[model samples]
Target: MPTTFRQHRKQDDPVLTVDFTRFPLAPGDRVLDLGCGAGRHAFECYRRGAQVVALDQNGEEIREVAKWFAAMKEAGEAPAGATATAMEGDALNLPFPDESFDVVIISEVMEHIPDDKGVLAEMVRVLKPGGRIAITVPRYGPEKVCWALSDAYHEVEGGHIRIYKADELLGKIRQAGLRPYGTHHAHALHSPYWWLKCAFGVDNDKALPVRAYHKLLVWDIMKKPALTRVAEQLLNPVVGKSFVAYATKPHLPKAQA
Candidate 1:
């Protein structure tokens, strides 16, 4: 049985919605997990048989993720021939060369960086032609509620600098010369939870409603059943908290004479 968020709220987690396995990650594909805070999606890529480069700006998170990758490697948890390495790097200026990675995952990351355009450029630069990139950010509506409730929510260090609307984000990606392909929302049940937190205080753990909602979300993530599935699916298009946009690097040739 595959582990869900509930069973293990570990640093390395498999997010069901992103569906990393669906990507065409063969044995030798190079995958980059940009802004990989704790190697959650990066570990998933490694487990799914891709060579993963987990990059993060936070030194501590990078250290922890590196440890987990080493541990996973020793334990033989990663797919045969799959490997991962965590590196401390800035998203705006990726340390890798152009066309270095076949796939790039940037989940819940762009919102935190100020120069998101620079980051997107770096993502597009490192990705090989015809490679795919997946980016996730807080959906507009839910993020607006949080912003309206508390300026402090976005003011702190490592906090979200901006909330991205679906079209705006995709447009920026397209401007960087990538072709947007598919988009979806995720974590539908968790929106109200953040709303409650923002209503009370972004850091207020004493709020009963927030605590209760958090537990419920944890429960839902852990024990996936028919009811939650239907509810999440129905709610996703309406009130999902995170928006995921997938795009591919354009590979079309110039018009010939």
Candidate 2:
């Protein structure tokens, strides 16, 4: 009886958008949310009736997510058939056997890994045939603005090592043996909000415009409706903050076999 958080709040944004359509989990599915920062998507999977494993390199966040999972279990917020657990693990080398999960999520994580190919291969290795994987990275245009604004923004500890173009990422996924199925942009409003922050200072949330825009973005995610819907969809392809691509492991044997 784990707790659940309704994620219907952002039907337009990229990460959650992919979760809604691309990563639709059925009851009894085994799902993996790699680099699950704070477990947002993991919680959503559990709520949607999947056994979810939320993994991250950060032990603290994993601990917090585990605590929340425990609390949710006690509070009876999770779906009747779903459960969740959190663990610490690295993306480049996952701690699971081949074909371990029916679905895998890697949201806003690939950019942080230098060997993104290795990470993708690990994800592919653990996915069951015909299993799905959803990946989200900062969209090229918006990320370029941040790069132009400050060298330090992407140069500091745990900072992004590379910004991916959608096509390039899709190609990479294909190279890792997954078949691309769909692509979309999300968090359109948040792009300019982050642009404002990067222009001010990446860490300067205290600045007036940055602070104000941050609040607005938070409000938009919390109370999503018609206006945000039109705005996000209209802005996504052009200026969305994140690019999400969904793919599946083709259910075919290797050509050599």
Candidate 3:
């Protein structure tokens, strides 16, 4: 993985918050981490005893994630029956049959794709009726700040093409034939860090303020200090960096006799 990707994976809380109780994940559940960059959430699902398939278009990332999956299995980090596989595949044309997976997670990815609706349609196609899906994107307000602060933040190749308002995203999910039931924001504490990077320069890692904030974030993720934890919960609702929406594919209605 690239240094920046590793840093974010290590520091950033899992954006979709894969709490099984809320997300309808069960042991042996077939889970697809669509756009599973670096496979953080995919590995988590494996550890929770799910059969996970981590798919991404980046071949190198897929290889690295596969290596990690093997290492996790060898090290016994994952549960006894859990399994994982990684593959390089396009998000818009997922290589799976309809209703193949029970859970799907796409995080911080839609903003990068030009045909987001097509991707959502693919997700819906692969999910079994009543299966759960989680979609996350950079929230409008904070993402707008980053875009305003530095064109470099979004103007690059494969960078975020648009910011998503919460309602707009949920609306798209509903349009895809999924019934949205829950929504929340996350990574509240990491918002300012991006703003600072955007303000200074995305590559200015040597800047004192950015470096300091990075350390603080790393510490918070590693140590989970109560003060920072509570602070993040309080801030998440107001300025959380990512908007997460959860929905389920609706089961077909019973035919009248």
Best by lDDT: 3
- lDDT of each residue in 14-118, candidate 3, tens digit only: 333544556766889999999999887897788789999999999999999898787777666678778899999999999999999999999899999999999
User: In TM-score terms, which candidate is top?
Assistant: 3
lDDT of 1 by residue, 63-114 (tens): 9888777767766677788878899998988899999999999988889888
Candidate 1 deviant stretches above 4 angstroms: 1-17, 21-24, 252-257
Give model 1 RMSD, 1 decimal: 3.0
lDDT of 2 by residue, 173-236 (tens): 9999999988888878888887887889888879999989878777766676679879888988
Best first by TM-score, ranked: 3, 2, 1
| Window of ten residues with lowest summed lDDT in model 1 | 1-10
- In model 2, residue pairs whose N, Cα or C atoms come closer than 3 Å (at least 3 residues apart or on different chains), thus clashing, are 2-72, 2-73, 2-78, 3-72, 3-77, 14-186
Model 3 poorest ten-residue lDDT run: 7-16
Query: Stretches of candidate 3 above 4 Å error?
Result: 1-21, 255-257
Model 2 — which ten-residue stretch has the worst lDDT? 3-12
